[model samples]
Target: MKTLFILFFSIPLLSACSGGASKINGHPNIVYILADDMGYGDVSCFNENSQIHTTHMDRLADQGMIFTDAHSNSAVCTPTRYGVLTGRYAWRTRLKDGVLWSYDEHLIAPERMTVASLLKKKRYRTACIGKWHLGLDWEKDEEGRTLLTRPIKNGPNANGFDYFYGITASLDIPPYLYIENDRVTTVNIDTVEATSGKGFWRKGPIGDDFKHIEVLPRLTDKAVGFINTQSKQAEPFFLYFPLPAPHTPILPTNEFRGKSGTNTYGDFVLMVDDVVGQVMAALDQNGIKDNTLIIVTSDNGCSPLADYNELAEFGHDPSYIFRGHKADIFEGGHRVPFIARWPAKITAGSETDEIICLTDLMATCAAIVGVDLPDNAGEDSYNMLPVLMGEKIAHPIREATVHHSVNGSFSIRQGKWKLEFCPGSGGWSPPTPEVARQENLPPIQLYNLVEDIGETNNLTQQNQQIVENLTALMKKYISDGRSTPGSAQKNEGETPLMMD
Candidate 1:
């Protein structure tokens, strides 16, 4: 009787041990999908009045927590990407004034920590699979023929990405061709020509096989292919899929065109939705859906072309009642769509309004993997895992959030109050002849976001005390290299005064 009893207990113990082993080996796969120049209202989940339906993106929101008050650190692509990878504001870097060109050298310094590098230390397979607009040193000769320069350095590969397949800059920009690691897939400068195709830019070496209209579909195909290929590998992977759709040249695939009644921009958004669906399908096909975390967001708000008077007549408000688009230091310019889904960790159909930034992604991933960032790394990132899991209530992750405009204007947000350093709209509007004539406006602007989501009211004169307090906070953050995690850098010169 005693032997039989002991045998029964041993059987259960063996089963328990097997289950524990499986659990120990299971690490969640992570995929971060970032869109370029997509607005808060562009996604149907966030904008009720959006004429177009982003079914896949909306489904993603339904499966995870939707962040209503999320924002990008900068109002443009390159800066926002820098913050996303390094978890530090782009303004702190030497290239503080503007973004880089296609031929520009690597923007990310080798010493700087990146999301891919940090994850690599923890044994994660990292790959950047889409638009890499952060800049890289393209191989070129004096004759202008693309040559094999020293192995591509100081870019994604040097920054910790195990594999990279993308472009050096926006689709409309020059040197238009797919870059696979250190070499261009198809190089031909002789056949290159400058064309004014829709919103296309001039002077680029485009491949003969490449067309401005096919970029979005091609990028989507590459992203889906990468996910499938990486899933077969032994190590769990982290895929940074920054899509090039809905940004410029608004070229949706023929099948997707005219599908949305809104216009070309709307059609482009639909293509983006299809891309999301393809990614999700790939994850499921690989049998890793249950163990993968997928996040979808934008680099910043929509562009002014979506707001050009003719486009606006169709009843599309890219900013969706927010003050400005793309380059302004306002809510419409910086606020963006953020959705994260992890079937095992985050509850489906959840939502949160806590203010968060793309810069926080590095810290959040670090916290999930049970790692701590060194002082120099992720100096601006705040871990949002608790908030994401619906475990925290009312506790704010950030005390203040900083914003940068296209023309290098600055703004700081603390709680509901926001302060902008420049007077007129800090982007294309400022240098315009008509806006320059408006002498009644102050040189600085302040708004209470809680009361003025549209930013129609500027209270710089009425609220002197709030302005002083927020301005001091903003100045301190600017003088310091980062606002949250690291020590402040000592100002070498006289600090800029806090404007009222």
Candidate 2:
């Protein structure tokens, strides 16, 4: 383990690192590619023992910086996406548990300030090109039946993106069709059989051209096309390429079907890596590689559907050394692989252990454009530009990062000590919520992550004082509404925190 320090003077380095005229107005083109239910160990570069090889992801990591301790704001898709774009925890909103389904109302309010909306203020061409699980408003017919004719009123287009090319929710959900900007490309009048067991997609109405296997490839083509188009423009652009693979209906294209030498999920990961290669090649062909800042990360940990038993037989532990998978409060659920490539700025092959959350992107981008965000916005985001520039920031960038599970379980982390408010996994591990309550398990659990990264030992009974301190801090963060220093705001609803 390396002892890293934060030295705050990195703004000057940003200017010095600006390579040439390729930079548009002192800012680089930003492309954020988020993977769905991809594990930290899925990428070979992140885990040496990983059986699934991701050559493109490895090369990208070698060319840039990797955050060893990076995490998504929540251990699920919709909530994490909301936190990433809005710079606030999703728990603060009305959706405290589970996720948004297709045909649900838009989660992002019309007045909410998102990363896309914020970047638009600086004249950046913004586009969201895949898996928009944050929710949308659907039109209805005279008979109260859902209608796909009219364009969605408050979707990605209304939330600040100039264009939106993606699906309304997970590929497994109903009304399977592609959405361009605000309108569905075609109406879903035909019903598709349930693809469960093979991958797990519910039976629903699907568009004529909407094939489960073709979604990833089509999205890759669109993302590459968007990059090529930007080459002709003088303004920097922001592309949020959220992939919808390795999550459900693990349908790997024919070309990538047998590539991983593992299961279908592994093959799907290889397909995702190929998409990364395509995006990188597009930047190269456009001569924008030097001026483009590429980011690759996952929304959360791997899902159980990836076939943990089969993968383990092949020497691949998707969650690496962590205990639980996707929805747990443990490391495996929230910690994800994060790699950033900026040829004009970041040193190649650099790695950092700085604790950071996905929500930090809002403030990081704000700092890149030299804009001061209002006190009301990006309240939970911290500027990690210094870390990106390989400089040590003077003050602590974050006091602590809060973790959320699919079941609305809450956990707080400050340095090495972590306090989980729930007794069991709070997700999908042994002693299910029902079982834990029946057996009369302990009320809370605590772990010093520095000593026990696996969270095998519980220190709650011994460290009552530490537990009390962290518990108080979590409460304060909730009451204050905003985590970072700013004006205190009001939570959209009361959080059902079980803390006494």
Candidate 3:
């Protein structure tokens, strides 16, 4: 790890923009809960017109700061998770587009420093308690087949987590089983097939005890249990709870099926909210609520599998005012609900429009522990600790942020001007790949988001100079191997001149 920082010395030192007082007396227990496939408007605190009743999520907002301009580093699951853990954009790696399947090799290189790894340096007991879509290194059998029983490598435990209990991929992916530490919990693995048009799960092998409907509750129970036990220890703990609900296999428990009164998807969102409430209650019961920094957010925007059309018919809009859904370059695809509550530090019920990315967690956590991060680590992360502590800053936290879609399309946002490197949605939305080419649409699209929040018009033709400036900036960022000001590090692979 020391050698990794050798090249980072040239990075400029970062200072927290100060105004408000921060009451961080000592180390606090950190609980970062991530919801899957949840849109920005899915939470009532974010969207006034949201039909889904999220009592618990709203309660969380009332107790913390809600960020109106927060986003996942990527529009899809795997990449976003990668960015969350590594604090580097996924496009910088070999995975240029799409997501990793259940059996894909580990995405995190062995040497990379993750948020868990960074916090462990501060003597915090770290645990990841839910979905880990970022690829894992599964052992091989005698015949070279994927060996599930053997101890996996380059996984959560190997990547700096002191303990881990979670699924290997999305609930819809194959080889459904529970992993505790580095090994699978169950010995039996029988092939089973289950399908749903709305839920969208691929049929594959499963553990005898694994049930899709029971996964959320089971994960929540484990999280609460971890919180309860860790609370007794003298050392502070960091729990990374990445949820696996409201994505696919939208299985809301029987008790919550009709709770939302809109659809199964809406009900599942409510169920996610309840899970948040349960964690909050656990913290309270353990007498660690005030000192615990509870952050509740989603991996990305809601997936289309949730039936947006039907949701609208029921007067509920998952994407709300944003156009397009998950996997697109639009705000609706990657912009998600972000809330942080630290009773001892952050002001309650406050809000900020501070542009931020989920990847920034690494730098923020590092700041919390008063550790200086090397340039090679968290190349794209900006320290938002001041904002988290409710400090009013004079300047923007980030100079520019990059956005990636499922199809490897790139978009860069600097202030209110955004430049997309591709035409159409750059995802699953209308103007299909073939249609985009047939219609001979412009190769790039630019938008002045300040004037057009819905992205109803393209300003590429009118602002050629701005387009050129943004394009040059994007190229420089990719070529420099980092978005932040630092000694140029090495990228895992070459980024194409055109992202495609």
Top TM-score: which candidate number?
A: 2
lDDT measured at residue 131 in model 3 versus the true structure, 0 to 100: 89
TM-scores for all candidates: the values are: 0.90, 0.94, 0.94
**Residues 219-323, model 1: lDDT tens digits:** 678777877776666566678878776777677777987898877878888888888888888877766665566778888888765544545666667677687
37-106: candidate 3 lDDT, tens digit per residue: 9888888899999999789878877988888998888888888888888889988999998899888989
Which of 1 and 2 is ahead in TM-score? 2
TM-score for candidate 3, please give it: 0.94
Model 3 stretches astray by more than 4 angstroms = 1-25, 497-500
Tell me the lDDT of model 2 at 387. Answer: 85
Top lDDT hit: 2
Q: Rate the local accuracy (lDDT) of all candidates.
A: 0.73, 0.82, 0.81
lDDT of 1 at 281: 86
RMSD per prediction, one decimal? Answer: 8.5, 4.1, 6.2
- Model 3, backbone clash pairs (residues 3+ apart or across chains), number: 0
**lDDT of each residue in 1-500, candidate 2, tens digit only:** 00000011111123433322243564657778888899988989999999999999899889998999988888888999898889999999999988899978989889989999988887788899988988888888889788876868899998889988999888888878998998888854688988777488998888887888888889889988987887567677788888887789789878988889989989988988888888888877765666666778888889888899999999999899887888888888899888887776889999998899898988988888888989888878998878887887775589999999888989999889989888777777665556767787787889999899999899998999999999998998899998898989888889967722
- Which ranges of candidate 2 are over 4 A from the true structure? 1-24
* Cα shift from native, residue 180, model 3 (Å): 0.8
